[model samples]
Target: MKANQPMVKVISSGKYAPSTLITNEDLERLVDTSDEWIVTRTGIKTRHRAVDETTSDMAYKAAMEAINRVNYDKDKIDLIIMATITGDQMTPATANFVQAKLGLNHEVMSFDINAACTGFVYALETAASLLQTGRFRAALVIGGEQLTKIVDYTDRNTCVLFGDGAGAMILEPSTHERNQAFFFNAARGDTNNTLTVVNHIKMDGKRVYLFAIDAMEQAIRKVLESSGLAIEDIDVIIPHQANERIIQSVSKSMGIPMDKFMLNLSEYGNTSAASIPITIAEYYDQNEVKNKKILLVAFGGGFTWGSAILQL
Candidate 1:
């Protein structure tokens, strides 16, 4: 007894960052840890630090990139949904600030979704659903995080695992694409225990590792069933870049080669919610996502996880 159109897809994507580099070497200065140790544990060599850059700055940078890539007029966008927990302030949604800084006209709706690390994928699903109704012509899905602000640099366990940056995707209605075919779902494991400060990027590395593989494995299967497609039919997997080991395990268990997946976690650590979007932006910069069956799977705070499958 359901009636509707079909699925949605991403047309163009962009990413941006500050020039400041916060390397593992720098971490040694603020915390009791060495670059070698950090890399050995997290596969992260360096991460960007806004330093003096605000969250709006990163969001703006990303938004401009997507605008250029999509060749979209700011006045033409239908909605702007930023996937982030690190909004620049408590008031106006970071999406609005980003919208203003990007000089986007008010023809679109703008807001933020805070699913921590799962932000980008969740934002995509949200914006896609909005477009499925035929009301939205274009959507700006962005993910930006300034984790360096809340990070206790002295806390080795947490400080070593985050970076700063932003990513944006221009989602437009694909005339040939069917919204009824897109599949999306999110599952929660156990992070309800820390939902209070859910927007603050809380994490237990070991616990996340254990839950990530299992949760991602589950999320992947759910979308596969929903989309009526097989994993082998998917061209590339864009996973939340939280850790090398976790990504590796999921790829292995799914029988998907490492090359079939994207990896930027080695350099960014866990950029909290910004991981997936930033990775997608970087990958597309290299012209990787063309004419492919795309899969986005992510897991994060709230112990939540989900997957999205679309043809691009």
Candidate 2:
């Protein structure tokens, strides 16, 4: 609502998951877990596996789909932000590889953000701030992850909870007054290593579950209060696809109906940063989202958590 603040709008979105499907039955062959157990605990029946695809490969595919959705001029896109913990290389940022694959000839500000599951929300807030300066016209914000590569198939605890996928959205300056977006991001340094991925995805499930519920409630309340909107005013909520219990807990605690939340973790498990955008893109593909109020929230490793509200 500041006089000089520019409004940012999402022009289009796209999502992509690997062709390989790993059902709970497939997991039974590798780990000592059952379909009923996985479903009862995590609500994950199946997830996608990236056979030979790199993080950048999926990111590029997702970006192209988003770009093509609006016939956006790639030449005019001045910024590219990719959110992922699983990069093909540890040196150059994954955003650089995505730019090259997209065949963008001009110089643009390209970088990667690693906030774990909250990465996409962080990237969106960062891009929106830059665009608000009127220096950047358009930005391609992508969240992609190949978690299956790092997952320990033998460890049933973390193995069945991750999948591979990518999602992308184009952000541009908006003229509509109601199209403005608001964001709230926060983080906690996990010195105790409650959740981390140094060698592989290792987490204390009980600790993470407790943290997730608190973070979700705090973020949702903070965004709603800051935006001067109530829970009833929001149309849809796209939360990180981590666990079914975490979301259900938050819903019960907040007294919100589960139907208001968009979820695809049952099919894709937790794709980390890719969850929210992937769900949003897929939902938009099937439903009309124009001028509707949307809320996005996530909690991830690094103890990072955040929420964003925007109109599509």
Candidate 3:
């Protein structure tokens, strides 16, 4: 290697969950739902519960796991980006606490990003821009959502769709000719003041289904068009785990097969911003993504949607 190469490459990725494994059947006890009902509609079988774990603890655990996977000096970590709709506090940004908890006290800059379920993709876009500008060599981007905190367990329509967990990734620029410099984009719909109920996530399942399919199709097209790659060129698609129907519909509309898209929503449900990173991590564990062109598309509550095309 030379004196100083541009930061490139995902050093490692990590994920963590609570001790409790709450299955859809367990949800039947708490709400008017059945395992079959959930499985048929959303393809969710179970999700992790925090079990007294705070968002801070979960975020730190995921960060440590990512750091452990790589040998980079902690001092070189210049940025920490955290994506969460449910930050530990409504005042202090969760990234500050993460930076402090991880002993990242080199006067590094950090902040929280919120695009509801699209948070991780948004944060990753930010981290990638920092990399391109040479403003930061190594960045820690985490998507940790304690969605159970905000979920209305009494509402069967929404409650069964969420879980608690954290997923992390280490990113650095690259000079090597690998799967790099693909497509990156984000688009948003106007925030629905009428649809919102005083700062809470207002989700109408049917409405979201329509929105997810539409927004996802647009984002996917942008990634393909911006990168000048055909839809057939992508090897795997790591889309946000909003629901099974949405994933399938998008795949079909794009003229792609279902097997080309990764599935982890059945296990983790929807962890808001954590969905994308967690899905990617699960795919990594399976060793299905290597030297492959991947398209990551996401849509979330903010009505925010994004996509990133990578070859890795």
The candidate that wins on TM-score is: 2
Task: Give the higher-lDDT candidate: 2 or 3.
Answer: 2
Report lDDT (CA) for all predictions.
0.78, 0.92, 0.80
Candidate 2 regions off by >4 Å?
Answer: 2-6
Positional deviation of 274 in candidate 3, in angstroms? 0.3
| Residue lDDT tens for model 3, 1-312 | 222222357777778888787899888999998999999999999999898788878988887877775655777888899998888987688888888888877867788998877788888878877887867878889999888877777878888888999998888877675636454456556455312324344577777788889988998888787777787888888888879988888878878899989889888898888887877767677784557777888887657888887656
In order of appearance, the predictions have TM-scores of 0.91, 0.98, 0.91
Over 4 Å off, model 3: 1-7, 176-179, 189-201
lDDT of 1 at 157: 80
Query: Per-residue CA lDDT of candidate 2, range 1-312, in tens?
Result: 634434798899999999999999999999999999999999999999998899999999999899888888888888999999998889699999999999988888999999999999999999988998878889999999999988988888999899999999999987777877888999989898998887788989999999999999999999898888898999999999999999999999999999999888999999999999899898889798887889999999999999999888
Instruction: Give me the runs in candidate 1 sitting further than 4 Å from their true place.
Output: 1-5, 178-181, 189-202
Candidate 2's TM-score reads 0.98
Ranking by lDDT: 2, 3, 1
Clashing pairs in 2: none
Where does the lowest 10-residue lDDT sum fall in candidate 3? 192-201
Shift of residue 283 alpha carbon in model 3, Å: 2.0
Model 1 TM-score, all chains together: 0.91
